[model samples]
Target: DQQVKQNSPSLSVQEGRISILNCDYTNSMFDYFLWYKKYPAEGPTFLISISSIKDKNEDGRFTVFLNKSAKHLSLHIVPSQPGDSAVYFCAASALYISSGSARQLTFGSGTQLTVLP
Candidate 1:
């Protein structure tokens, strides 16, 4: 069973507009959520992250919001630029009782965001 899912496979936004990406998870153990942006030939690069303790976290043009009750999260990018057009992956990390440290991330399939000029 897939714990994390990005229902929307793709999204398109006009340049300079706001772009929103959504993700949902079924695991209640998740305590940290992160967003990564990946280019066609490059590895996924960490963009922003939010802890379960907080509902929102922002870094520059990127903002991440988490809704624990709904098991959902979203990433918002304002004034979307061409460079921002890439695959955005939503990932979650949780502390496993069997392990002292947080386990590897559980990632969604990813949503492709295209910024049109």
Candidate 2:
């Protein structure tokens, strides 16, 4: 079964509005969470991340919130712009062993965001 999941397949928002994306994880071992944005055929670009120890992390217009108890996380983009239109993916990383040398990321399918101009 997929460890990470994004319930929403797509979201549309008007330019200059707020865009909210959500993700859920089933693994309690995941300690790190990241959000990536992809533009068509290009590789996914890192957006924001939050550690399990932190409830919230923000950068400029992007903010990530984590609810450990619920095993859920969310990404908020304020004042969404047309350039922000892309596919957003939620990823979770965890160490496979006590050595912490083998860490892998499990990613959600993706959520396409469309910002109407």
Model 2 ranges with Cα > 4 A deviation: none
Estimated TM-score for each candidate: 0.97, 0.96
lDDT of 2 by residue, 20-86 (tens): 9999999999999999999988999999999999999999999999999999999999989999999
> lDDT by residue for model 1 over 2-105, one digit each (tens)?
99999999999999999999999999999999999999999999999999999999999999999999999999999799999999999999999887794789
Clash pairs detected, candidate 2: none
Against the unseen true structure, what C-alpha lDDT does each candidate score?
0.96, 0.95
In terms of lDDT, model 1 sits at 0.96
